[model samples]
Target: MSETRPLLEVSHVSRVIDGKTILDDVSLSLERGDLKVVIGPSGGGKSTLLQCVNFLQVPDSGDVFLDGQSAREMSRRNICEFRQKIGMIFQDFNLFDHLCARDNVAIALQKVKGQKKALARQRAMAELERVGLADKAALYPSQLSGGQKQRVSLARALAMDPMAMLLDEPTSALDPELIGEVLNVIAQLSLSGMTMLMATHQIGFARHLTKEIIFMEAGRVVEAGPPKILEPGGGGRAAEFCAKLAQVTGR
Candidate 1:
């Protein structure tokens, strides 16, 4: 990896789903230890862009580069390896109903990384503790609150020791009161210097932590700059959009 290159870069990426253009030539980059937030109206390509970056939904055009290596050029085996280093957190906590929180976090370690069961469980516990979920490790997802389940999802991602994380509306599914717990963990990760690209509607929280805000609309990046760009009287599309959002959400 070249020191000068971005830790992650999406170059001219586009995605077409069912004859609709979801992302149109979107480009962005994240440097090591940086946190970038994507904020836009619903159906504005925020989630799709994050999915394309992780190759969960492959881009129809352009490419994603990790550590200066092109994702489109990697072999099948290498792609799997590459994905393991980029953690993903989704709006829905994708936990197995049958598995306890610990097992949910440990499964990938055993299945994908081929670690021994005991060691995986140990690491899973440590990650859970990091996310302040150690007490809930033995609980099933059905027994946990929305915030706890999301924290388990965060613990699962952190267990992988990813170089970068892509989060897509991670708090969207939570109740109004539950949102703060998940956001607290995310803020801690940012403070700890974890590189992240997050798509979220929590404009206030994002403005406080993000190094830059990328505003997208209609499948294109409309504006991107420091958080000040979204401030009152900053005079840009991002500022106008955020002002409207604050009015709607009353936050």
Candidate 2:
């Protein structure tokens, strides 16, 4: 891929489910190191957009290009290879209860990358260190706190050396006090230049760190701009939504 080209592009993408429009001509782009956030009410189509970008939910129309390769064109086998470059982190953490943090991150490395066991473990440890979780590497998911489990999920995503990551309400499942720790890890990733698109209700959090925030509602982008939309009387429906969010979140 050319350095000048965007790392990810969602070009006029649209999707419908059971006769309802889920995404309506949604288009956005992320540069190589850009960290963008998506904000909206529940069921506003933010998660669907991320899924389409990762091809977990294919769009009925339009294209999702990752480093200039269209997801639509990838053959079934090629889709797996293509997805290796796009990491996804979900709210649930999704770590296996049976695996220690180290093994959770290493299994995919060994199975998918064909790395030897020792090499995968070494790399997994490094990713854990990057997320400030190297000390917790031996713990099972159940033994870790919610924040630590989410960090492990981030570490697992990072282990793949993906060019971009899509996070879906990553902190929504965490306890109130644990949210900061997970957000801190994501903030560190942003500062370290990991390209990311996050769908979150954390309006207060995004104001300080994200490069851009796209406010989505009713299956379309209502506002696509900087974080200033959170200011009082910023006045569009997007701004109003953000104000309500700030009041409710106390952020």
Candidate 3:
């Protein structure tokens, strides 16, 4: 791919379930190393859009390209290869409760990449350290707080050394007091230049973190641009929504 071209290119994307549209003709271009945040109301297709980028949920019609290669044309094996380079974070912190945090992170590297046990554990430890949870590495998810579990989840994703990360409302499930910690870790990732496409309810977080913001509603992108573009009298529903959110959030 040309250096000038975007790292991800999504065009005319749409999804439907039982004839009800979930995503409607959405399109975006993400340059390499860009940090993007998507914001909208609940059930506004933000999660669905991230899934399409991660290749976890295919759109009924549209094109998703990674580094200029069409994801649609890739074989299952190729898709798996593509996915290994892309990390995903979920709102629920879907850790395996039965396993220790370290082991949870190690499983994917060992099973998916066939890494040796010794190496995998080492990698897990490094990732956990990065997320500021090295001391809790041996603790099971059941033993950790919601914020700690989310940190471990992020460590697991970072362990894979992914080219990009897709985060779906990752802080939504945390208690209000605990939310800042997880967001701090993500903020560090952004500063380190980890490409990310995040769906979040935190408009202030979006304004501070993202280079550009994408606004989705019902099933489509109503607007996308730098934060300054969302000023009052911006002339779009997306900007109006953001204005309202800013007022509510008191940002």
TM-score of each: 0.98, 0.96, 0.95
Clashing pairs in 1: none
**Candidate 2 positional error at 241, Å:** 0.8
Question: Order of candidates by TM-score, top first?
Answer: 1, 2, 3
Instruction: List ranges where model 3 is wrong by over 4 Å.
Output: 232-235, 246-250
Could you report the Cα RMSD, in angstroms, for every candidate shown?
1.0, 1.3, 1.5
Q: Model 3, range 1-251, lDDT digits (tens) per residue?
A: 39887888888999997899999999998887888988888888999988988679988999888888898999999999888888999999999988999999999999999999999999999999999999999899999999999999999998888988899999999998999999999999999988889998887777887879888899988788887666678887767887888788776
Q: Backbone clashes in each candidate structure, one number apiece?
A: 0, 0, 0
Q: What range of 10 consecutive residues in model 2 has the weakest lDDT sum?
A: 242-251
> TM-score for model 3?
0.95
Q: Candidate 3, 186: how far from true, in Å? A: 0.8
Q: How far is candidate 1 from the true structure (C-alpha RMSD, Å)?
A: 1.0
Better of 1 and 2 by lDDT: 1
Order candidates by lDDT, high to low: 1, 2, 3
* lDDT tens per residue, model 1, 43-137: 99999999899888899999999999899998889889989999999899888899999999999999999999999999999999999999989
lDDT of 2 by residue, 146-194 (tens): 9899999999998998999999999999999999999999898889899
